[model samples]
Target chain A: MKAEVVVIGSGISGLTAAALLAKKGKRVVILEQNRRPGGALKRFTRRGIPFDIGFHYSGGMGKGEILRALWKYIGVWPRLAVLPFPEEGNENLRIMDSGKVVRAFFSYDRLEDELQRVFPGEKQGIYAYLNKIREISNTIPFFNLDLPLTPYLHDLFSPKGMSLAQLLMSLIRDTDLHAVLSTPVFLYGVPPREVNLTIHASVAHPLYSGVYAIDGGGQAIVDAFLATLAEAGVDILTGQKVESVLIRGNQVAGVKTSEKEIYASHVIYTGHPTSLLDLVPGEIFRKAFCNRMRNLINTDSMFIVFGAIDDPDTLGDLTWINYYNIRTGLDIMDLDLRHPEKSIMINAPGRRDSDSTGASGGVLLIRMSVWDEVARFDQGVREKRSAAYRKWKAESADKMIEQAGRLWGDAYSRIEPLAIGTPLTFRDKLGLPMGATYGVRHSMNQFSPGVRTRLPGLWLSGQGTLMAGIMGASLAGMVTVGEIEGLEPLWYEVRQCR
Target chain B: MISDEQVYQQVTQIMAEEFELEPESLQPDATLYEDLGLDSLDAVDMVVALEKAFGMKMTDEEAVRSVRTLADLFDLVCRLKNRQVTKE
Candidate 1:
């Protein structure tokens, strides 16, 4: 089979690129290893209860916002049913800091008011802290679109150039206030010490605008994108794993999948960039690039516990807003991989329809787990592990439940079959290398070339290449296709979309 | 006024690309819709491509509507370029 472009991985990045290219009259074929599409946006049902794997919630879906504009350009906006988080009360975040949990509201005045009550003496410092992030978020070229791209590159070196930790220290003297403002780092999967201030601000600023959950869950967004792809006549092949990228001389000739050899001039690999070396021509990819992809240190993986509550009111002090039950003095930079009670994120997911069992469901994400802990279980092989692995999985689920009970002051009443996702699960299921969340951590000090590669037609897209999350993946898709098509016209087109 | 020779070269190349046409098939008097199968989507995409290529906004609705044939498009582009030059 032959196509103009063969895109591997049916994640948001690959799907978006395929859709846009098809619209431009390119015959595109999308290959996904899993039976379903929507990579991170993929959601599955367990005992008739739907649980989202990567998608929890999103920011910037409000009218005329950057995320909204992007979705509109992708043709998924009109059908998307988005609901905002609490307008008051829990605000957006309840960050657990050292010796105390910091409460922050979405409103600037309210957040400032809450912080001022805690640190009355540091009023101006809080104001400066909030203003700086807002400035950094607004200045990003991708968000504004109309702004020239050159200024964004200079941001890492300009006055804004500094690790989030340094900036927070230089501005806010109080450690408690430092912890509160930098809580968004948890979402970025990076500690303040390593995260660039620019990246931290982009992830945080959207929170203040408002965080939103889709009415029908992430499945709705996936369906909408699928509909768009179908209408554009893009061929989507599922359960087809691309074995290797066929390269002749210096350019990508096609891809050999489990099913057949699909020929294409251009192959866009949206899977883990580190895994690309095994697939592509090594000589053409060069030594330095391959070495970097090989030697790159991935961020820590997560241990998630999906549990069901019989009633919503039964969830004491747990509003729809997510909470970070952080144990203060614990260095986020170096988390104790096991014993998740050290630093755990209790995500208060949106209420889904109770199954026949009649119970609401929520997730508890402990971002501490490491791959080495689970590597002992026969590698690359899943579900066929010994009784010891199964026993370990059960004990870990109970441990998370015990942690949650300590926080909520009540043993989970009528807990559902606790579904636990570990690093091994990420590696075996999601195709992440070390089950690394956000593959290849991007820092301001390092240079990660996005989309473009040394190979003529083989390109890279997805969260690993650029930023992480839905917006990052979507924008990465836009940038990759923009490179193929003219960036100027398409970039401006997205700007004028709303 | 911009030279007709310069306008023809630019117009032919731009139209050939935007409409996905062979340069040999493009005639001065050929209608965009009839000759190139240009539809509504093509018009919007063509307008964006032209605006980016010239680095000028296609703000005048009357000028956009007036162009029918390839020759009309060439004249329209020449007028717009001349207007920009006069303004500068």
Candidate 2:
């Protein structure tokens, strides 16, 4: 088979790149190792009820927003039904230690008022911090369509040394306020002490604008993307694992899957950056570049408990709100997996549906976990794990359930654990190294690889290349295609949608 | 403390190894883009290699952006190293 561009891994990034490239009159072929596409966006079913794995809710989908404009430009906006979260208290932060709860609103003015109300004496600091986030987020190129595209790379690297922790401390003095602001860290999987301020602002600024959940979860988004690709005449080959990227001299010739080889002018790899080392030749990349990719620190993984809410009525009006149940006295800067109860993000995926009944909705109790917790049981296959591993997983789930029950009373008491997922589950299912939830960590210490590679025709487009999450991954695809098809024209078209 | 000559040698060696340039070809005044054949992407990887080799953090964006020749990199590394020594 032959194509102008062969995209590896049919994840969000791969799908986005393939769709955009095909729309630009290029013959694109997507090769996915898994039987199903959508990578992390793929969902699972238990007892005939659907549950989202990777995506839940996102920011910047409001009218004229960056995500909205990108989706419109890609022709998926018409297919999606954007469900915006309530303007007041979309996310609730519950400090378990003190039993204090703070609400985060969608609008910046309302969010500021809420923060000021919660922390009585920090009005000035709250205003300054929110304004700073807006300022830094604007410096990013695609985040603001009005900005010039000449200094895209330079703008991203401008605020390199400053950490989120340092930035927060400089602006605010209250420790509790700092913890509240740091709740967004879990979304990016980086600690406040290590994550870059610019990266943090990029993730947080959008949410400050608004938060929204899609009507049909991640599966719907995947379906929309697949439909777009189909319309663009891009061929998708699932269950085909790419063995190696065939390189002739310094340029990419094509990719060789397990069954056969397909020739192409360009190859866009959307897997974990380190995985590329195994596919390409040993000497194709510099020793320093390879070493950097090998030593790149990954974001922390999760221990997720998927369960059904027996009765949605038991939860009352709190059913739809996302909860960040953080333990008191725990440093938000450094999260320890040993104490899972210390920090947990409780999400009700099914509650996003307007017609969701009590029995059909599902709840996900996700705790940030390190890979070491399940490393001892890594030797066995997914279906046949050791007895010790099962015991540990059951105990962990029970403890998490107990904590949730205590926090939510009778509503969580009826919650039954349908399945448990450790980092290994994420690794095997999502193909993430050590099951890093959000690919490479955007930290102060490490530099992530760029979209362009040392190899002439091999480019990278994934969460690892740019930022993390749906918006970041989608933008990464646009940026990679923009690099190939010319950025000014692409940006101009994207701006037209706004 | 490492002398200026050692810093120059180390920077040139890294450039030679990482960028596939000959050690003799790395002149002090040779332009990075035209002479050494390093593009914008190569500039990023070079910074990573230099940081790893010296065990120093190249946090100053302005200093890194100002590099156009081998001599500029040597001076920047020396200045950062001296600052690190003084801090200790």
Candidate 3:
């Protein structure tokens, strides 16, 4: 069926664009490759307990905060089940050298007081650092996914003037606090030095503002978007992977999937833009843009292990823990595969869940650093290598189980049906180029793709776009929607919602 | 010097306090999960709390791969602290 808009991939970006368009009374159809919606923002059931595969915790849930504001306008906030991280000992930063644990609480006053207690003389530095982050976060355009892109920063003193790493370094003297402040760097899985200060501000500024995890797991967020689209009368087809974007003359006519062909006026892809290149070549659009796509460096994918335990309360209530074993500083370009012991961040959602069922029923999340492709494994013989891969996965799971068992005592044995996702899994299942979790890494020289591409009526939105996380993807969606509808009028309506 | 049961008693108390398990219910050979029900996150917290209570520390990596039973944790603490006493 022909529709005004077709959103490929029911991830955050696709959901945002589709829901917004549908809300605006546009005929929209969303195509999701998975049987379920919510691409990376997903949840799975293990041992009858729902565990969030993606979106362990999120920032910016306070009343007027950027992400919360955007989500509230979209009717997502009201239905979302959100629980804040603990007031104290919420964000702990560990120094590998002294074994000193510095905790950053949700309360700004408490965080400041704790910093003073830990580093008596560094109070001034801490104040300046927090202020700089707050200021920088507020100035960046599309910070809330509602701002215009017109004012491309020529003003050097503006919030967009400095990179995130630069602003952070300017504020702190101690090396560990800087690393701790950038602890969330692993969330995007990029080095702190590479992350734009504006991105840091947008993420961190909201947390003191407030952070929350959806109680029903990541699926609730996806379901909310689905409900919004349904209410708007948008058709959604799951398990329909789009094979190609059918271009007619100079315009995007429609898309073809494994089972069916669907026609639409515009196709907005939520996956990596380059993935679309094979289906709809750059030669079809602009040759220069194709070269740009080929040249762009995709962000590193991750290896996540989800474990279900009966008693989650055994572990202290810490929403998330960013563990770095690296003794030195932070650098994205210096990610070394040979060095596996650097830092491994673990997020225990069961501890974070305010409405957790019981100590025996809570879930623990494991995220460790991994290179995109294990150099030894060959993807060409994947089908035949399934047995070998299973062996390796079991070996890997055993190591994790052994390590985890040390912590949980006998509760480690209770953890069953372990699911391991590698970069190859993302490549094979999600159709990501090189299994990149976030689209393209935003580099100093390289400009990540915008919502609009060179191909007329063809757009790119999602983790790969200029912005990387959920907030970033949603912003890209707004930008794409803005391009279709006049920006000023779009802002007028969105602002009115606030 | 504390007796073997006394050492076990102190260890169990810390484990119970940190992991929210009952001290009386915990046994020296009881697996944290198989018997008393402690998970990885709890294990890490227990190790940290043990260090805080005993004034010695265990790395997260060490806390994970090395820990198994309640007695295994007690041994680690004793070794890290250099308590040169044999188990009963």
Best by lDDT: 2
**RMSD (Å) per prediction:** 14.4, 2.2, 23.0
Docking quality band of candidate 2, CAPRI definitions:
medium
Candidate 3: tens digits of C-alpha lDDT, residues A4-65: 89999888888888888887888999999888888877777656666666576777665555
Return the DockQ of model 3: 0.01
Scoring each candidate complex against the real one, what DockQ results? 0.01, 0.51, 0.01
Model 1: what is its DockQ?
0.01
Error at B88, model 3, angstroms: 70
Better of 1 and 3 by TM-score: 1
Model 3 bad stretches (over 4 Å): A141-149, A152-161, A318-328, A332-340, A350-355, A359-365, A372-375, A378-385, A401-417, B1-88
Q: Give lDDT tens digits, candidate 1, residues A275-316.
A: 888897555554435555675557678877777665646665
lDDT of candidate 3 at residue A450, scale 0 to 100: 56
Error of 3 at A354 (Å): 5.6
True lDDT of residue A463, candidate 1? 79
